[model samples]
Target: MKVALVGNQNSGKTTLFNCLTGMNAKIGNWPGVTIERKTGTIKGTNYEIVDLPGIYSLSPYSTEEEIAREYIFKEKPDVIINIVDATAIERSLYLTTQLLELDTKVIVALNMADILEKKGIKIDEKNLEEELGTKVCKISALRETGINKLISEIKKGDKLKRKPIYDVEIEYLISTIQGILHSSDSKIRHSRFLSVKLIEEDERFDKYQTQEIKHMTGLLAKKYDTDFEEIIATQRYNFIEKVREKTVIYKPVKDDLSDKLDKIFLNKWIAFPIFVVIMFLVYYLSVGIIGSNTVDMVSNIMDSFSEWVGNTLQSIGTSEVINSLVVDGIIAGVGAVLGFVPQLIILFLCIALLETTGYMSRIALLLDRVFRKIGLSGKSLIPFIVGSGCSVPGIMGTRIIENLDEREMTTMLTPFIPCSAKLPIIALFSGYFFKENSGLVSASLYFFAIAIIIISAYILSKLVFKNTSNTYISELPEYKLPNIKYIAKEVWDKVIAFIKRAGSVILICSIVIWFLLSFSFNFEYGVDIQDSMLASIGKSISWVFYPILGENNWGATVSAIQGLVAKEQVVSSMAVISGFSEEVGEGSQIFGNNTIFSSFTAASAYAFMIFNLFSAPCFGAIGAMKRELGSNKKLLKVVCFQTFLAWCLATVTYQIGSRIENGTLHLADILVIIAILLIIYLIVKNSINKKKDKCINCPYSDSCK
Candidate 1:
């Protein structure tokens, strides 16, 4: 049996799904839409449950709504588990009413029932069930209460009675359209539902459009002196209100904990500062002194293991080439990444805690105004936050964003946030360059990334997504203590994913890089690394970074290039090439002591960090970008734009910082200064052009005369 879980945003539908399925869910996007579809099997049962994207209505106003409506209409699942927030039943039942119009079994799961009880809101579930013509099950998804009962209700296969939500006139029009659809031999399975949808001019049913239906809709609009869609919507809302009045009893209560906490956390003057402090704490705990201690412990273990492996192989009389491959290539490379797992786990834990406690959404609420000024919805912030953990899901999170332009822009910019894969690089570089202030240095990179994103957003809004508007509508869930079990599970899952990547992509890349670095072009072993195949290839592309790093350091170039496979590989590659396989304390220490990094000044090291942080993400994230973008052209455009921006910014940082530190100017410095001036001039010229082009006929236009 197949069950569909449907509900509004923050309605606890996902929590219920997790409770039902445990850890056995498969997550993917709906066909042709970015809206996520999560499917899982109920434990020890043949029943399959699908959790649809959260939507406010079945009116097809957004892609999420369309996906939900289309899935119900096409798939006709065995049961519809209509999850509704018990505290907001009136608002939620609007969708429930529409669901009842469908010919399927619907068991209304009144989620967050505990919250309702705490708030002194009494919901007459039996009355609600009778009014909506379905069985209602009260559940607290957070506590995993009433899940068995809800599942039992689903297994019972109780069908809901279809009810009319509109007046006689609208009903007559719907029936007329239904009759027309039948007469035309349209293959639309749900004629009644399609008829109502057609009357509302739903773009999904535009194919079934006919003169008769259009004429009848036009007549209805004329009679109502309003939009036909609005008329139908108003009636549905009215029915919802009536149902609420009959079934809901509310008692006034004093300020709750959530409200009290929001006063300080969401205060305008302190909210942003609090967010900054929280983030700094996350970094401090994950990559600062605490994280570094953990990293050192892990690194020492890896170092000891590598030494053991080398000794064992030598005892067995392993070949020198084989010994180097095993010790330097595989062990050092993969070990370099594994050493940062502690830090990654800590970071993921903090992010998971923020997400579960619902503070992430509050951050979105607080930043909405600022996001709007950059031509993005506050929803864009969610992706950026998620990106801090990893960019693939961050880009996928863009599905919640409705505006196509804003979604695309958000996808493009999300990788600018330092993801978990990039954390090792930050730790390595910061530890090497700043030493005692590694945490502060790593934290500065995050702020620098945000600065880049804001500036890039502004530039892209004007240059690419001109005149695009974004609408921000988000539901802030009540604050609750985060579930420790959930946070641990999430952190474990992320760590496991990182480990898998290290074993697979990073492992493969490591072997290949080792081969190239080990052999000359003629396949002769034991050549000087500078004369080896990898070095030759690296030299060919090394000039790209000369402006930033002050020399064509093929080792640095190779590390940067390898980062495209996985960001951690940047440090790992450097570790292998710099002969730090045995040391393994941190890549920074290895690089700092090696002659390979002798030419790198603190300014150049930071420039390198900036470049790597803002460059195109790893192959996995790039594939995600391609999938989310759904266009080869757009993906290529984004890749090129990201690379160009990283180059310009890194170049500027190196040239200007070098001059400031040493009080010396070079030809490249002059060229970089000119480039910066040109960029400023272009921005100013674009602003002037926009002012000149403002519409004179419009009241809001600045050039109106």
Candidate 2:
């Protein structure tokens, strides 16, 4: 049996799906988290459940809404499990009304019944079932309550005799459109649905009908004294209000705990500071002493294993090249990334806890005021937070933003947040350059990324998206204690994914890099790495980073380039080239001994890290950008912008920082100063131009008068 799960955003639909299918799908407390559909099977049954994206309605206004509507129309699943939040049934049932219009059986799973009870609200399920013409089962998906009854209801397959709920005039218009569609060659199976859509003037079905339907819709709009779509929406809400009045009973109560907590956590004066402190704590615990100690332990174990393999290979008379390939190429490279798994696990766990407990949504609300100043909506916060885990999904999360320019700007700036893939790079550099306060260094990078994003947003708004309005609305879920089991599973999933990539993409790239560095252009074996093809290739573009690193070090240049493939590869590539098979601890002198690290000072290392952190993301994220941007020209523009920003920032950091540290200035320092002044000039000029444009459009303009 195929079951399709549908609900409004934050309706606990996904939580119910997880309970039914026993799938560890990532659930967030915000909308647009599940932009794509996911499928899983019931553990003890032959039933397959497909979890569609959370959508408000079948109006097909957004991409996710369109996806949900198309799947229901085309796939026609056996049963539609409509998960509705008991606390917000009126708003949720609006979608439920649309679902019932389709030719399918729907079992309404009233989720969060416990929350309803806690709030002294009682739902008359029998009355709801009778009004909606569907079986309504009360279930608390979070606590795993009443799930068996819900399952039984799904299995019973009781078909609903869906009654039309439109007004007399709307109903007459719908029937007329249905007759016209019936006479045409349209392949629409749900004639009633098609008819209502025609009256509503839904663009998706415009190609099916002709100018007659549009003309009829125009007449309906004139008769209703509002939009045809608005008329239909009003009818649905009127019906839903009646349903709520008949079935729902609410009792007065004192202030709830969520409200009490919100007084402190959501307070305007303290919320932002609390959010920053919370984030700082998360980073500190994940990358500071605790995480470092765990990583060191894991690194020791991996080092022992690597040594065992190497010694065993040597004892068996393995050839020099094969031994080096296994020990240096695979083990050193892959192990360098794997060693940081503990830190990644901790980071993901913290984020998962925040998401599960619903604090993330509040963070979005708190940051909305700040975002507006930079011409972005609060919705952009979701993508930025998600980007901390991975930039691909983060970029895809931009779909929730209705504004095209805001979405594009959000996409361009998301990669500035250091993702999980970039953790190893941050860890390695912090450990080496700022060993005493690695956590502080890492956390500062995140804050620096935020600063860059804000500044970039302001500049982009002034130059590209002048006078863009900032409008955002988001639902805030009740705060609940995070599920430990869910947090553990989420953390494990991320750790496993990191390991898989290390074994696949990073491993393959490591071998290729090792091979390239080991062989000359003529393909001769056992060539000196400095004289090899990889070195020659790296040197060709090494000069681009000379200002940042204070030297034309091909190793740093190559590592940065390899990051485009996978961010973790930067550290892995460094380990492979330096031949550091064992744990590469802080100030290990591995790179210092090798020529690659010989010229790098403390400032240069930081510059290198900043450059990689703010630069263009990995290929996977780039692919996501391509899809989201929808054009190669835009993608190219973003890529160039990212690279330019990274270069300028890194150059300024190295040149100015080196001058400050050594009390000496050079020609590069003067050039960096000039570059900074030029950027400021451009920003001021763009702001002036934007003000001029705004004045030109103003009603008070002298020309308009």
Candidate 3:
């Protein structure tokens, strides 16, 4: 038996799928589209469950949505599990009404129904089941309550179809359309579904348009004197309102915390500042105070473990080359990546807390006000939040933004936000250079990346992509208490993924780096560091580093380029190079004036961090971008744009910063001034040219809906 799970964004469809299949589908308050379906077997059964993307309706606006609607038509799964957010059942049922028209049986899983009682609300499941003509199960996927009953309902499948809810004329029109589809193809699965799509004039079925159906739609349009789509929508809402009257009961309650908090957190003037302060605190706690101490403790243990392995190899009379490979190559490189696990835990924990509290959703609504002005959709923020963990899925999340221009632009800018893989680099540089101010430096760079992204987006919207429009309406989930289990699971899963990365990519890269630095160009073993083949390679490309770091620091150049493989490899590469360098000392002295890290100043280090943060993301993310953008041409354009921006920003940051510290101005300063002026001029020109374009701030944007 096969089951398909579907729901609106944040309606807990993914959560219910996990509960039934014993799989871990990511859960967040943010509205993210799953570009691919995830499949898992239901526990103790042979039944396969496919979790489709979170979508608002069957009307396709993206590839994911089109694929999801296609799956129902072609795959024709035996059962459809539509998970509905019980707290907001009215809005949740909009998709439910559409799902009822499909061929398969649909079981409405009222997820989060447990919270409804706490909020002084009651639901009549019997009434709801009777009204929709399907089985209804109230289950809390989060708490695992009423799950067995839901599973049982899925087993005893319903034979009933969607009851007639529309007026007599509409129902007559629907039946006539269904006949037309059946007459064309007797093997068609979703005749009823296609019939409704035809009446709604859904563009997905434009190919199915026949003269007879067109004549009928023309008559209806003349009679109604309004949009055929809106007519169907009005009927659905009319039915939904009737169902709500029968099944729902709301009781009086005291003031909610969400309202109280939103007054301050959602305030027009102060909300943004509060968010900024909160982000800084989150970074400070994760990177500065708590993270620094925990990292030191773990670093000590790792140092000991490395020493022990080296001593054991030597005591066992292993070759010096083998000893160095085991100690300096594998352990040093991989261990450097692992040392930051403590910091990752703290950071993931902070994010998980925000997500659990439902504050993350509010950020989307808050950002919409600001995002629209900068030629971005509020939907762009969804990818930004997801990208904090990794840029690949963050890039994938751009599928939710329906606007082509906005989606492409968001994809181009998403990598500017630092991902978890980049944390080791951040922790490494900030801790080494700023010391006690590591967190401040780390957080500052984060907000700085965001600032640069905004500026770049403004430039792109004004000068490049024109006549772009964004249509966005995302639900604001009610604020709730933190779920401890969920948050812990979220943090632990991410931390484990981080460790797996260290063991795989970082470990392999460490061996390769060790080999290159160990052997000369002729493959001679145990060569001097400066005479190795790696040095030659680094020297060839190291000239590009001169503008950023104000010197041709080959080691820094090599490490920065290694980040393209995996951001964590940057630290691993550094550890490998420094371990091989004879001048580098132990502990904090590794970055001292006489060591391998001596070429770096505080300004250069910060610039280096910025460059890597905004540069072409890792190859994994580049592939994701390629897939999302749909061609090599678009991917190459984005990659070049990213790299060019990184170069310019790094150069400006280094040149201006160094000048401030050294009290000198040179030719670089003039170039930086010219670049800034060019950007300002572009925005000015765009503003003047587009002065008569449609204003997005019109209050009646939602009037039709």
Better of 1 and 2 by TM-score: 1
Q: What is the lDDT of candidate 3?
A: 0.84
Which predicted model would earn the best TM-score?
3
lDDT of each: 0.82, 0.85, 0.84
Q: Quote each prediction's TM-score.
A: 0.91, 0.89, 0.93
Off by over 4 Å in 1: 24-34, 155-163, 172-188, 207-222, 580-589, 663-705
Better of 2 and 3 by TM-score: 3
Residue 522, candidate 1: alpha-carbon lDDT = 100
Tell me model 2's lDDT, rounded to 2 decimals.
0.85
Per model, state how many residue pairs clash: 0, 0, 0
Models sorted by lDDT, best on top? 2, 3, 1
> Distance from true position, residue 153, model 3, in Å?
2.5
Instruction: List model 2 lDDT by residue over 1-705, tens digit each.
Output: 889999998888788878888887778666777888888987689898988888888876567777887788888898999999898888899989988877678989999988887888999999999999998999999989999988887789576667678988778877888888778855657788777887777777777667887787677677668777777888899999998999999998787888999999999789888988988887887788765677557767877898899999999999989998998899988998998887888889888888778888888888898898898888898899888999998999998887878888999999999999998888888776777688888888899999999999998997787655678665788888887887788788778889999999999999998898888999998877778778899999999999999988888889899999999999999888877322343435335544466567778878888999999999999999999999999999999999999999999899777887798978886888799999998888988878888889898877753
Candidate 1 has an lDDT of 0.82
